[model samples]
Target: MSALLRDVTSAVGDVPALLAIARKAGTDAPQPGQGRTARLWELLASVAAVDVAAARILEPHFDALAILSQAGKGPGHMDGAWGVFAAEGPGSRLQAKAGDAGILLSGSKPWCSLAPQLNRAVITAYAEGGGRAAFAVDLHHPGVTCEEPAWVARGLREIPSGTVHFSDVPAEPVGGENWYFNRPGFAWGGMGVAACWLGGAVGVARDYRESLAAGAEAGREPDQIALAALGETDRILTAALQHLARVAARIDGEAGASASDAVETGRSAWSEALRVRGTAAAAVERVLSLVSLNRGPAPLAFDEPYAKRMADLALYVRQHHGMRDDAQLGKLTLEEECPW
Candidate 1:
């Protein structure tokens, strides 16, 4: 096991320990679109390969820091674990209203993972003027409350995702109306999640290889069926990794250009992010199928680590939105001059 994996595993059930890892990463890890974008993705993938739950906790903290940096702000005095709570759904919507003490947030925000454990978060809410805006809010504010998590999923069980309610909670605006969605960092953050999925698939592939090796050590020569599955997994993972690297390079190149080119950069980055995410999600699904079909249920039933990784990966990749995302990407392709 790698050092990151070991550290994450040791921090699994301890929220403080996990937050320590996230805080350290926020200070040390390279932000997306910096010169070392590939390294950032690699770090995310490495954490996921060890523990998806740990990655789930860490990715958002890194993303929150990136969002701040992109807006020319820094964490400064505000410290500890951070998260991004921007998911919107039907029901009580979070609203940002001008208050005597700056902007205040009210109502409920959905899908806030690890909200109770985080010290702060970058959240999106309906702004007073009409459009959505992003704000950095203290999760520990007296008016803030995280609902009892209703999470029942087996994968990422350690991270509880639920709604957080605010009642005149003070907030500091991060960006202008709709800027959160319009920024290039938005697309880059999605790609980071894809990196975690890729890493989870890598962990599953590693287990499949180990199982095959163990069989061989017991005087059982590997059959062509197992060998074929292994070869296919190798192909899938290699393609995914290469695609991630290529996209990372593109992001860094775009970042080095003039500020006047931000609109074009943002558009290109969004398209590339969609393509890479779709590709990585498909690769992970194929790897899961091949490993499960060839290895059967023995490892899943008896191997604790392998079983947890498979379960975690299965649930985590669903963030890709499958066909809905494909349709969106298809529409994007239709608009491109030469999408092929």
Candidate 2:
């Protein structure tokens, strides 16, 4: 395990400590498609293996840094934890307007995780002209208000995603109109989330393995069902890891390709991200079912870590968007000359 992963593991239950680790890691952690893309994902997975909540906290912080880097900007004098808040939904929308003072943001943004704890964020809002644009804002600004989280989820209980209301908050534009979604890094960041899902499944599989070993040590011979589940989980996780590595290689391979290929490269990345996320999400679901059915309710009823892992993995993977994402992937595949 990497030192960062080790630190994350040791600080699993402490949110403040995990945030501190994330702050420090932003300085050195590798960004996606930066040649060390594979290592970047491996680190994310390792962190998830120890604690999904820790990965939950760290991924966005790292993603925010990657976003800044992609825009030819760095954290510079800014310090402390950072987050990316780009999710859009119904309700009051965040809007950015240019003023005599500067660009100012007002309205509410949903799904702002760690907003209360983060010092800064890269947020998306409707630009003065029309399309959405990305901006960097200081969370400590007087006009910023992080609403009290109403999160009651069992998994990732440590991280409560909440809404933030901005009242004429001063902001600095990060990129041009619609640049947030236009960049290939958008797809790369989605794959990073899938890596975390893969790691959570690995953690659950480890629990199952340890259980089998304990049974064997107590002079109980392994049953066919137990062995079969283990074998199946091994197959599932192995395939997911291989798929992730292949995607990482593709990302690195296209890093500095010709500008003429930029459009095609972005399309390829979007399709690849959809496929890998689907694969990892499916693998996690299958492993969860296999482990639960074979191991029965004993672990869920008794083991705290095992139970938490199950719940956390269950909730975390739901971010993949399931059938909706599959439909988009199917359309993308159909557009290809030879999808097979």
The runs of at least 3 residues in candidate 1 whose Cα sits more than 4 Å from the true structure, single-residue gaps closed, are 1-3, 254-264, 337-339
> What is the TM-score (0 to 1) of candidate 1?
0.94
Give a tens-digit lDDT track for model 1, residues 79-135. 878899999888969999996788989999999998988899999999988999999
Reference-based lDDT, residue 121, model 1: 93
For model 2, the superposed segments whose C-alpha errors exceed 4 Å read 254-264, 337-339
TM-scores for every predicted model: 0.94, 0.95
lDDT of each: 0.86, 0.89
Q: Residue-wise lDDT of candidate 2 within 1-340, one digit each (tens)?
A: 4788779878987999999999888788899978888898998998888888899999999998899888888568347789999998888699999989999999999999989888999999999889999999999999999999899999888888999999999998888998888788989999999999999999999999999999999998789989999999999999999989877876776545454433235567788889989999999999999999998998899999899889988999999899999999999988982237
Q: How far out, in Å, is residue 326 in model 2?
A: 0.6
Q: Which candidate's TM-score is highest?
A: 2
